[model samples]
Target: MRLRGRKGIREDLEQQQDLVVLNPEAYKGKWRERFNNDYPIHVEFGMGKGRFISQMSVKNQQVNYIGFDMYDELVRRAAEKTRIAWNEAELGDPTTIQLALANIENIEDIFAPGEIERVYLNFSDPWPKKKHGRRRLTHPRFLEKYCRLLNTQGQIHFKTDSETLFEFSINSFADYGLQMTNISLNLHRDGINEEHVMTEYESKFMGKGMRIHRCEVLVGQDALQEYQKSRLDKY
Candidate 1:
């Protein structure tokens, strides 16, 4: 999707800088302190319009949620959605949701080791070319970064509409030695409809009769080490 420049996008983002971490580099290892709570930090990478993260934060006040996207315009829109959601939900503290403009390729620079409890990859780019396999969010390189950022029991919850990407991600996770569970080829058809926050892409795709694939993988130190060794062996 080509992103057209939005008017006043810069100014809009500046106005919500308090709610969005414009300088994520400064918070790097101290994200928990920024939230002013030890509540488990959950992040949604590629949080396009922010519907899922905003709703998730509103519903689960105990968890601190951060939504990351590469575009300022997208982050600004997400911040607005979060603010509106907080007001409608009548939450006392709206600090539960934090938006950030950062590229996923450098996620390590934004988060510290063991700082995040969970990570969500919702409708991420497939990077469908074989030559672009390494660029996929579920690729071994990206998974390595996620592993370092996640705590002992941290898990990745991934949802996608692309079957090819889903299958590739499953193999990637297995190759990295991550333990997978709650695997569903067609999420909505699996009789697990409750508590599922629908994202814009998810709603559109599912409404068009496209099945959404979902999976959860637990990160472990052993898996990380094995993945690292495999990478070394490729040299």
Candidate 2:
């Protein structure tokens, strides 16, 4: 886990947001004002380096996107890509996409009640140890956080190459009473689905002949309560 010299990369990230801190706490319930749009806000938790979100934002100008990643170095790299997009006139506008350094577990602090429209959990870290199961992005605890942030009928689109995490997520979704839709075991076999955005990790993993697992779970008030109850039982 020894990462080489990347301090300059982190410094680059700091430079990108020199004028403002993209901490979620500062913007918390004011997402609408931040983007100056009433459109639904979709977020990608653990945006590796922002490749996926940047490309998606450029392709779809109507949807507002917020990418939250914990690593400062990673956020900086992603922010650099975003800066490039903003500079290019032919790339359309991505003023809707905001990058933030924040923990995914703190969704309440990052988003107001029912403010998020969709969540993309792409190639998230799979805490393999059984004791670390709760830390998994698809765990009930994390799912509850996402459920609370999402608007009624909001959806979570998840893509991962890990079968263990995918199974864990599917069970969590069904157990929590969320409607699971469009479950796919192999993404590339489906003829390059437009809805499926590829992350940096996804590109590398899929290149090695891996099967990408994906699913969409719809969130509602009723589902939120059920998710909360299930998470409570775990404690």
Candidate 3:
């Protein structure tokens, strides 16, 4: 996870106003308005290099997508890839896809409650250590935040190559009272679904004879409330 310095990456991203939202906070609750459409907003957290989001936005034009990453260089590269895809598809409007540089811990600052319809966690950092368990994206704290940000019946799709992390995520989702489905232990070896958009990590791992794990979690009003109650009880 060592990031190489990219010269002028920030300046370049700032210039791509149509692709990267430099001031994401300005459109916090009004993300759909920025797209000029009421399409459901889907976000991919930790969208490294942006390969999956770019392809998904092109394939599903009806759903608006926002890719969030902590690094400006990675976000810039994602914007570049998305722009190329849009151009190849001959789509004049690039509003369907947007990139943002932000930390997942402060996600609430960038998105309002119930503003997002779906979340995608692709190959996220596992933070694999007993002391770092809380840092895992699927931890109860993060799941609670996701519940607040998602609309009723919102869904989260997570894919990973780490079996330990995958197991932990499954348990995390269950502990948070989120409903889970579409579980797969070996995504590619079992079968590649039509809706599956191969991520950069997925491709690389599969090439190395590694199996990918995938699952979908649904959050309802009751689930959110239950998670909140559990947090309150802990205090």
Best by lDDT: 3
Candidate 3's TM-score reads: 0.91
User: Candidate 3 overall Cα lDDT vs. reference?
Assistant: 0.89
lDDT of 2: 0.79
Give each model's whole-structure lDDT. 0.88, 0.79, 0.89
Which ranges of candidate 3 are over 4 A from the true structure?
A: 221-235
How high is each candidate's TM-score?
0.91, 0.85, 0.91
Model 2 TM-score? 0.85
Summarize candidate 1's per-residue lDDT along 81-145 as a digit string, tens digits.
Answer: 88889989888547877999888888888888988889999999999999999888999999999
For every candidate, C-alpha RMSD to the true structure in Å:
6.3, 6.5, 6.1
Error of 3 at 166 (Å): 0.8
Tens digit per residue, CA lDDT, model 2, 1-235 = 2234375765565665532145679787898788888877888888877888887887688988888887776677787777676667475445778888887777787678788889999988888899999989899888888877788748899999999999999999989877876799997984666776688888888789889999878787555566667779999
- When sorted by lDDT, best at the front, the candidate numbers are 3, 1, 2
Off by over 4 Å in 1: 190-192, 220-235
